[model samples]
Target: MRDAEISSWRQWVTGLMVAGLVIGTAGGPLVGQETDDAEEGPQQVIIERTPVQLRDPKTYSVSLSLEPIREIDLVAVADGVTGAVQVQLGGAASRQAEAVRLDSAERQLELERAKALFRVAQAEQRATSGGDANAVEAAEGRLEAARAELRLAEHRLDATVVRFPFDGKVMGVHVVPGQFVRAGQPLVTLADTSKMRVAIPVDRTAVNEGDTVDIKIETDTVQAKVETIVPLKAEFEPLRELFVSVATAVLVLENGDGKLKAGQTVFADMIPRQPVMEVPTSTLANMEEGGRKVQVIRDGFVRDIPVKLLGQVGEEHVFVSGRFSAADELVLSSSEVLLDGARAVPAGAEIPTEEDEGAGPAGRRRGSRF
Candidate 1:
């Protein structure tokens, strides 16, 4: 019975195979036509390539705006003083102040005469045995009045000539030559150009004190130091006028040649000296249990590298600093099923060089690895 069963099963399998062959032969033309149609159809996939940028460690820089280290508005201290404008409209404040030395010689002489008269009155009183106290009192009153008049005269002299308080440039002169300026009236607007500074937003977390900054003003290159980090307060209240949403910091730069002027817009670069690695954000895989990671091709094998996202260049790329090699071929685009440690074949024409990476602003992207 077991032998019969085996023979019967073999016969059934042979019959099925024969029937399949017959049907396949009968539909041979139809199968060939279907294959031809498939070949003519739009089945070819066109995959565009984006090179993986193997960015080495480099100095990171931040954009900044140039401003004067110090600015002031000169005003009249005393009333009805003729404005001579000792400084030219666009001249240095330090040089202009030197020319406006106030004449206090007459006031000094008046003060000396008052002292002599007061001494004579005291001598007379002593000779008369403290009698005629009225004379002594009168003389004291006169002396006090003379002193007051001398002070007034000094103030008047100061008011007559506009003195430059610092080394700066005259931005504007509200008073004309021979113009009578009233008390508290604005005389001139001055700004110290010997050094320049910028108020950066407080959100710049990378910026710290002692960082060297580079800037360009027309044809001149200016180098400056991060003198201090000024916080929001009464003194820096003016910062609110420019950046109201975020807190700000003051970055100072030396402009000894006076190449930089207040109100002139210039670009400043705060390049850090530390070593860092920058990678494209698109190459990053996803946030897993471990951390943010990116897929790189090494020795024709896939690798998932952990990366610390530092910042974004723009919308398409990110600035990442991590343990990465400059020669690493990053997988910019890959299939959805490509897994870490799996084999991969790069489809890009060439990897991005350092020069190509510097062409545009950096950016970022978000997605999971395929």
Candidate 2:
């Protein structure tokens, strides 16, 4: 009876061991499935960013005060001038000088004759030293006096007729014709508006001396070329401090059409022609070294593209350029943390097209708000 009981106990133990092996094998598939699911990672969706070719011009709206190319103050150059307005151009007042005793042309002829006679006498004196040298010297002295008188007469004639110095409009008339005026008296104020200039504050980096700009005065718009950019002087520091938002650059543009007038308020717009890439300002990430960078979604992976900051465009957009093609996909808004080599799937977000933004054929569009 003892031997049978021991044999039964051993069989019971073998049965328990077999059952444990089967249970362990069945749990293997379930644990493996859970591990596979964890490895699949969380759901992530990447949206396509609207890739804009910043080929359009970056424009700025700035109020400018127009100024003339030159402002001249015409004054009476001679004494005893008639204030009687003679040749009036652009509403300026001027008058011919009082009548001269001798005609300028006649005086010129007389001076030439006197010079010729003096030369002949000088030759004669040289040829015969003793032939009444004192008398010849006296004749030459009289001829010299006549020549001096001719010059004075010619000068007086010139002083009679007032000539306008440049093509411009007269801003003020200080004297009238027929009125006797003294030397150094103010005549008229002239402004050369054929070409106008405006001191436009601009970003020193964005503009150049030769760039072209559009100037709008009242209802007229004209193309003007940048003539020069005046450097900010210490004298203007007070003005700069007052206008803290404005730059110190002074833009001088050519307005040859005279459409722009001095003291007239105008709007100056500068457009750039070079091509660039436009991106939302939010996508930019600050670099550790310096400058800015952005994350690009390409081939289901993220790439950190180094971009050049080309200034801001619209309210929320910025112009940037570097290693990017028109077809390259940029991540606009992403659900997952943007990481290098991270797997991503496009969320099928609609990207804005050029047509929606009213971008012209050349991608021309309006610029910033301020």
Candidate 3:
């Protein structure tokens, strides 16, 4: 009986061992199946994207003060009493037009006297043509003296009238009729308003001389060209040392309509010198290391592209530079964390077409999942 029991116990132990082996083999496949399920699919994120291109340089609106291209105070050339003021304040004057005239009765009489003396000297020189050599030389000298006196008298008479140097508007009249005025005294203030100038402080790298740009004055928009760029004075050396890009640029604009005025405020559009890309301001993300970044879709996966934040274009858009292609699909926004190489899709139900992507910023449509 003991032998039979011992034999049965051994058989029972053998069966238990076989059952354990079977259970272990089945569990091994289950664990591998769990791992396969976990690794089967990539995380999906909802994203909005737009196609990017090397767009035109970004424009910045800078405030500027309009001033006349030329301004001058017409001064009296000769000392005299005011005879007449031909131009009124705010009146237009043509080039070389008489703007003021000083009293010249005495000068006119002097000119007539000099002319009579010159004529008498001419007659005397002719009468002495065949006379003694000493007498003829004396007559010739008298004729030359009288001629020079006549010229001087004519010049004095001409100096009595103040003429407009150019086509301009009389901004001020400092002399009145019958008012005693002295030489080198201001008689009129004239300004040429046919063209306007604006001296604006700008970034040295952004603007250059002779570049055409747009300017906005109230509701009117006009084109202007950069005339010159002046560096900051030595007193601003500290500013320059701190900010090397500071500079002053002078812009010239046509104002034939006289819409722009001196001391009037206007706006100038300044363009960046470097090529840049346009993206929504919300698309920029800060990097853990430093600087900023934007995401792009490549090969159905999300990838982070390092970008330099140039500046904002407007309220909604910003300009950035990066090693990117015109064909790149810039991810506008993402609902989930976009890890490098992670699979992504559009947030909406339908994927955008190539033509839709080219439709510009307004045509970009957001989808449900990416």
After the best TM-score superposition of candidate 2, give how far the Cα of residue 166 lies from its true spot, in angstroms: 3.1
Q: Clashing residue pairs, candidate 3?
A: 45-370, 344-370, 345-370, 347-367, 347-368, 347-369, 348-367, 348-368
The best candidate in terms of lDDT: 3
Candidate 2's C-alpha runs over 4 A off are: 1-64, 81-83, 87-130, 178-180, 215-222, 233-257, 267-370
RMSD of each: 18.5, 22.4, 20.7
Model 1 gets an lDDT of 0.52
User: Where in model 1 is the C-alpha error above 4 Å?
Assistant: 1-43, 46-65, 81-83, 95-130, 202-205, 215-222, 231-247, 268-280, 283-370
Better of 1 and 2 by lDDT: 2
Better of 1 and 3 by TM-score: 3
lDDT score at residue 369, model 1, on the 0-100 scale: 28
Name the TM-score of candidate 2. 0.42
Ranking by TM-score: 3, 1, 2
Candidate with best TM-score: 3
Q: Which 10-residue window of candidate 1 scores lowest in summed lDDT?
A: 21-30
Per-model tally of clashing residue pairs:
10, 12, 8
Models 1 onward score TM values of: 0.47, 0.42, 0.55
